[model samples]
Target: MFCSLVFCSLCFWHLLVFGNSDTVKTVSVSVTDGDTITLQNNDSQLQDNYLLSWTFERPESRIAEINKGARNFLIHDGVPDGRFRDRLKLDNQTGSLTIMNTRTTDSGLYEMTIKSKKDDTYRFTVAVYAYLIAPVISSDSSRCFSPLSPCSLVCSSVNLGHATLSWYKGISVLSSISVSDLSNTLSLPLEVEYQDKNTYSCVLNNPISNKTTHLNTTQFCHTCAVDSSEGHANCCDSVEAVLRLVVTALMGVAAATAMFF
Candidate 1:
């Protein structure tokens, strides 16, 4: 009875450790480019040596070629039409592959298989990633203020690199929390309202890269007219220009006006 109990405990202990070692064996996978991928074995049981192989599912093919005594190995198949070819390379030592210049069509499920001399086989799956290009702020320009003319600036995100757009002035943000789109119109209120021209800045920021750029200009007048020898132009032109200036300056105020009214 005693011998049987001791033998049973020993068997249980060996099974526990061996079962965990088998379960822990796996490989970490990543897609480097449209044509390249990397796979690394995570097993740390200190096994003697292992063979790594890959199989493509959708096309149903194997990359390994048969040789007399040597096991299957990864080789560059060259760039394939609508398929990753020249981009595939395998690092036997580290079990990694570099895919150069990835394309959208390269996305697919991949499988990595590892085999040991003892016939132990391990498999793992890797999912590829390619994020959609986000919005970006390309450039901004600003104009200084003149006695009769108000200051103005334009922020445009012609192409996208980052996401979520905003404008700022110094430490204080000039845009509202709701300001989150490209080519947003702005109106500003200067703390010091007077004839003396003050320097102001317009800042553009994107959420993804958290990048910001400032456009500086002299303070624009709130109720000023463009300098014209003929008393700020005749009634028609004067009204038109004044109306345009007011409209630009009032943009920022509109956000606060709703609360006040």
Candidate 2:
């Protein structure tokens, strides 16, 4: 009887351990604001008597659920906050959850549980980023006057979410700047020769998306038109000519005074 009781206890322990064993998986999802994002459970066909549940941020707050046995579908969008009101969806056939018009506030951990003959759990870490605008390339007006000096260019954009502004020469990165705050203006400066021939571009990017603007050296960098007679294109040429004339005049006056003396 003692041996039998020990055997029964061991069997009970094994049942407790193996009976509740379920597959759990964690996935990362990233989406842009105002876009729809779906978290899949890989269950194409759910059992006739199945229970699927989803919770957001914390496990206590249930966001959505589907029960095939009860023939019911529920969305607890009003639990955590009204931020998810009317934006949550669930697929009864595949047991997938989709959020429409996702916002940055909706970014957090989402947990899904499916209970049937086989139990499975899925955890998703969702991140929603604001749409990124293309960086604008403009030449600094103060630095554009001198044709002999390096041309100063600025790449600017309105910061959206966590974004980085980068200047690239061909495929290699020349320099980069980033800001974590949103709606602020971000600018990165790059200096290049007026006659630069290498390809360069400015890019604004986040983890999931990027926008690029190519640098047009001729469009942004302006050199003074060459004088047809002088065959030179420089803003300082006229000043240099004036200085030469003044020196020559000074020399002539000195020579005349010496002759008179």
Candidate 3:
């Protein structure tokens, strides 16, 4: 009875320590702020084996490799600087991979296959994003091409590394632009209908971060004008400019007639 008990205990212990090698495992990681990330295949018990081979598969790329015979670990050569380059680190002691300075192009599926007592595959999908800054809305305060057309307003962000800037009227987007590098700081233009009584806003965003600024039409311009493809109607000019002159002239004539009476 004692011998049977010992055998069962040893079998369960093996299962717990080694786990099911045939079963493939998956891990998901979200990296932000241009940080580093590490991926591990095995615990300390089987760390020295180096039986796992890491690969990037969405676009079919090579990542890092481990030799079972010499227990050597190295990141593959010829990978583009946009992919990994000198930023990859492999630990032979624990069979883990660390990538330094993660970028948007580094986002993809990474797979690891282990050939120990059983064949196991591990997959990691990495998503990297940068935080976006608040967008600014600027205009000349002069309606472009008169009041019938959309007033030209510029929405932009300054020195953003990787992000998208957008102009919005409520939930609808008028325009959006995505830039990885801030060669020019990025800007997008939109035409706003000042007489429409609708609120507008500027938005900057990424997969992980978002910032917004509401646009006040009063700050840019103060006239009510609706420009339609059918026709341009200057509401402010008709109500305030033309009628006010006629009404003032009529009031002067009435006072002259009253004094004569």
Candidate 4:
């Protein structure tokens, strides 16, 4: 009877070990972005029915229980700033998560835990990240300048956070500025003496985002005449008329002197 009891105990222990092993046959996952991830079911051909489960943990942290089902999944919703957020997905059919907008703060070893119908469990790790959006240049209006006046060139960001600013002329940097918020302006100094009809550009840059804005300067001269039709053939016609009047006055004086002679 003693030997029989011992044999029964050994068999029970084996059954427990074997049951646990069969539950976690395989585990796989997919990374979305800084905050989102997808877990996939790599093992389709399980010999027995098992409940798939998941768990997440940071380094040296306690395991957090996740959702459970035939295909189980979970997401880390409470992510901090500069970290990944709202970017994890799990496909029930395929058992995968589609991550979105990965960032540097999202970098960490993520773990996935699973359980089977026999109450067996398994775990795996995933890394997360936060991808930064580069800055872009913007202006209050596209047609910023009017005749004989200087307009301010403003630069802003589409997707930038806590970044420095810079101004450039083509390849060369003109100045460097900082922005506490998302928007800031670098106004170019305009002088009446600085009258060259040249195309100018101001560049805005953060480490992640970079962009440029163009500025056109308008000129007004005192000696310049205004044509009624403005920028048409009448402009040339008006200049020709003024030139003819000057020539006629000079020639009429010369004819009177020749008649006296």
Candidate 5:
């Protein structure tokens, strides 16, 4: 009988450490700022006498709890630095926790514990990224010597968080640059012919969202017709001279017709 009790104690200790590993689950979630995210308990339903608790960052910092036996559902968001105050919601049925208006500071580890006849734990690693901004496209006219010269264009954006800035020609990427700083200015350069016909775009993106800006070559790079006599003259000047001559001829014709009438 004594040997049997010792064997039972050893078995219980082994199960306590090893068996509990299977009951724990971990998940990784990514979300954008000002968005809401829910961490599920993985429990389809809760019993009448179950206890559920949630902690953030560390185990000792309890942020939420639910006690069905005591008929209590409490959110302790005010305890841990008040970062989650008025932003946390708890589901009474599934014991899932939801965070509203999530910010970048909320990116961290969260844990959930459920106790009844069995113990179940859930871990979530949440990453909240800032909203992305559209990139701006500009041309460097100093690099252009003639109308046929390649235009040097730059794509730039203010990085609110970790993001990648890329230039794409159609669907293929031409070049890219990445920044991990919280606040920075990122720029990517691309050169193309003034008359080249191709779809181009600049994109700024993060793990959660992306923004794009289409390139309009005609708006930035002005095409001028070659004047053989004057070497190199702006086409706009020739067009304006023709328009003035036409206006002068039309005025003379109108004056002659008025005199005849």
Candidate 6:
């Protein structure tokens, strides 16, 4: 009788260890660094027959447990571990997990399990993206005088991951440059009229970060003639605009001399 009891206990332990191994399923998750992330089941709703629980296996810890009945009780008072005690949130109704102010250390797979006729399980592969930095905008000219020239407003920055640099005129993007294979730095120059009246700016960005610098259009074409059709086009032809202004002035002086003679 003693041997039979020991054999039965051994069988029960083996079932607990290997019976539910196939129930662990994997899901994918991506979240911006320093942002809040929630892990939940999208397909199934909580029903009367099953109970819900969550486990974060990468940290080797039990995250949460919930009972489904009217007298629903939260095991471990809803906090299952020390690392997540301050920032973890458990939904009383759906048993979803929410992590606030997430960091790189928090990136890992999370699992949600339900005890029903068949044990249902879901896994999530969580990833936290790095934050981005703003770029600096520089000018490649000592002074932009009446003689219009092709001056470049250079925008550049160094950071991890991917980034894009762009030049804008008002609300519209004049041009954009992108770099993905680069480990940390990007730079681009947007050539434009070297006058104060032609407003422009440079912007830098990544998936999680954005930065911008505005051009002092007033410093570019300090003196400009308004073109009725294109707003500022007649004022922006670098060398041509200056040549036209000089020729027009000289012609006016010559005409005045002839009238006096």
lDDT of 2 by residue, 1-261 (tens): 011111122222121123457777676667788888777755557779988899988889898899999889988888697889998777778777778888888889998888888887777777888788899999755333344567778999985788999999999999998887776788899998867799999999999899999998888787655577887544543544566589999999999999989
Q: Who is ahead in TM-score, 5 or 6? A: 5
Q: After superposition, how far is residue 101 of candidate 1 from its true place, in Å?
A: 3.5
Question: Please, what are the lDDT tens digits per residue for candidate 5 over residues 1-261?
Answer: 011111122222122233743476666677788887777754467878988999999999999999999999999989589999999889899888889888988999998889888887777778888888799999755332244457778999885688999999999999999988877889899888866899999999998789999999877776655678889544543445567689999999999999989
Check candidate 6 and list the clashing pairs.
Answer: 27-123, 195-220, 195-221, 196-217, 196-218, 196-219, 196-220, 196-221
Q: So what's the TM-score on candidate 6?
A: 0.48
Kindly indicate the candidate among 4 and 6 with the higher lDDT.
Answer: 6
Top model by lDDT, which number?
5
Q: Give stretches of model 5 more than 4 Å off.
A: 1-17, 20-22, 140-145, 224-261
Candidate numbers sorted by lDDT from highest down: 5, 2, 3, 6, 4, 1
How much is 114 displaced in model 2, in angstroms?
2.2
State which candidate, 2 or 3, has the greater lDDT.
2
Assess every candidate by TM-score.
0.42, 0.74, 0.58, 0.35, 0.72, 0.48
Worst 10 residues of 1 by lDDT: 1-10
**Which clashing pairs does model 2 show?**
none
- Which consecutive 10 residues in model 3 have the weakest lDDT in total? 1-10
* Cα distance off (Å), candidate 3, residue 187: 7.1
lDDT of each: 0.40, 0.78, 0.68, 0.41, 0.79, 0.63
Clashes of each: 12, 0, 0, 29, 0, 8
Provide the clash count, candidate 2: 0
Model 4, 259: alpha-carbon shift in Å? 42
Candidate 4 Cα misplacement greater than 4 A, ranges: 1-71, 75-87, 92-96, 100-159, 162-164, 179-193, 196-199, 206-209, 219-261
Considering every candidate listed, which one attains the maximal TM-score? 2
